[model samples]
Target: MLWWGKEMNEWQVLHASDLDFLLENSSSPYDYSGDNNESEYCCGTPPCSQDFTFDRTFLPVLYSLLFILGLLGNGAVAAVLLSQKAALSSTDTFLLHLAVADMLLVLTLPLWAVDAAVQWVFGSGLCKVAGALFNINFYAGALLLACISFDRYLSIVHATQLYRRRPQARVTLTCVTVWGLCLLFALPDFIFLAANHDERLSATHCQYSIQQVGHTARALQLVAGFLLPLLVMAYCYARILAVLLLSRGQRRLRAIRVVVVVVVAFTICWTPYHLVVLVDTLMNMGALARNCSQENHVDVAKSITSGLGYMHCCLNPLLYAFVGVKFRERMWQLLIRLGCPEQREHVRQLSRRDSSWSETTEASYSGL
Candidate 1:
């Protein structure tokens, strides 16, 4: 992985046509390549050692914290949403599914944590399952956020009539469609990812078997998982912002804050990772020149940024659900029922204060 000089250039020159073809057909300017699988190869140059000391030290702790925080946050979201006897709003339904997606994503983290600290101890079958689940939920969470944004756009800007009647059915269909798309995106991982021993790393690792398959997977991830959903969110939020701005009130201000916070949080958590991965992808695809130093820099950056990206799963509940008056109220009620009877009056007062902020906002938004 560290040796990227003359031999790497020769390989790039040999595969130049293939790389161009991939770039031409790819959906995003920045695509994902075999960043994860790069350590498996050594150009015909003298064997060079790529240090995984940072990965071993950093990743296990990162994944463990993410798993714990994500599990607790999404678990609370699911529990509160399910406990309610009332019919769910479109936003609520999406939040529930988003929680489920985040939960699924976090559940895979422990296995990955183990993989990072040691080696891929799980066999091939479990590796494939865990990898596929990771990919699916990674995309699903992003797409579901886009769905929430689009739903908000329709309700706030166009005020669509279709959602006014039998909205639950339509929401259900949308969630199903999103999951199906995510499954399709993860299909390559399900088929190709396996636990294999890497000579360079001298450890077993789970990654794509075929380099081309890794390129394809990365392309899909960058395009569909990141870019497509990013576009959808940007457009939806832009329109939602336009409508919110026209209204004159503190509610409008709070709604605007919600829009800003959601977009900013998503961008902050994900953009760096995607950009670093994109560079890795471009190098792998021969779209960019490769050097050992640059590759090593990206290797470390990818680890750091990917950990930041993983943190978004934990942030979802706080950003999308807990910030809302209704959801908070529900959570408080659940807590009170569970064991916080003494705080019931305090919860009611806090709920009433925030609930009065905006009736429409309460119904339309999960968070502010």
Candidate 2:
């Protein structure tokens, strides 16, 4: 089964006039597949087949480090949240979901690294599961972050009686809805991800093939995975900043700073990855057909973009550690609880502060 129809005819066979016309009119004429027999379509020329090389030397090391750190960090956050007896506030609820998303996403890293190091030995079933989970976790995290920003904006700027009525329940329901949406969005990966053998590389790759409904899958990813979430996040943060500027208080300022940091970190980590994905999608669509010779450069750019994305997996845990004071206090309490009974009072006080901080801040922001 060929993805994107059989390879196109070679570029070299076209007369100079045709070539000139194509170059002049098309943005990316080289993106189309040419006949394999044509000199122009040969490896050394423009429109040449891409040589995707998997560099295995550092894959194992990188995966092992990320797996260990991501699990430990995110696990600590989950442990702290679970141990608390307080009814989950909206922030707590969102943080818990964010930690879970990060943890689940990192869980699949080892599998990907193994695929990078060797032929995808894990069969089609495993590939589909991994790919689906990866997309679900990624989109879920983005959605949760946007939700967090909106929650902050509501609590700070638009404080109304509506917030007081079952705030926790509403937040829980929102988180559930986000997860449900993410799962639906991820459905295509489960259906379309396949294991294919590349004869040239003598390796099996777990990739989305162009056959069948791949184009639909790509379009869905572009919209759901990137565009929609980004638009929402941007709007939420913009409103958040506006509100922060209007309401002046030390506590409000601190909260705004933390929220801004979270948003900026998310943007820094995800923007490049999405940009690369957009570029790759466009390239595949022949948007850059005339620039086929630029493929090598584009491939290099993609590598950098992907690397930045991978780094975000590690950075998320660090962000939580720094941003959430409750997280830090609880982590410390856990450690102290393991060592001495004398620290129990301190832990209790910290928990109390964690639970009450929002309510107390609520009154101040409520213009009371």
The candidate maximizing TM-score is 1
lDDT of each: 0.73, 0.64
| TM-score (C-alpha, index-matched) for candidate 1 | 0.85
- Stretches of candidate 2 off by over 4 Å are 1-54, 161-163, 211-216, 290-293, 340-368
lDDT of 1: 0.73
TM of each candidate vs. truth: 0.85, 0.78
Q: After superposition, how far is residue 161 of candidate 1 from its true place, in Å?
A: 4.3
Measured over all alpha carbons after superposition, the RMSD of each candidate to the real structure, in angstroms, is: 8.2, 7.2
lDDT of 2 by residue, 1-368 (tens): 11111111233124456556655654544433345734243234443455445335455556667778878888877777777776756666787788899889889878877776676788888888988898788888878877776766666567643346888678778988999999998787787777766554566767665332555665665677667766776886687567667765556665555546766777786677567656655665657553655655665555555556656666766765687565566677777867867877876876686664654443432100
Clashing pairs in 1: none
lDDT of 1 by residue, 1-368 (tens): 11111112223322345556645554533343446734223332433346668878998899889889999999998998888887777777887898899899989988888877788888889988888898899899889878877877777788764466788788888999999998988888778877766654567777776767776777777888888888999998888777766775557557545545766688789888888877887887778977677767877888888888889888867864645556667787889889989879978797678766656565456433
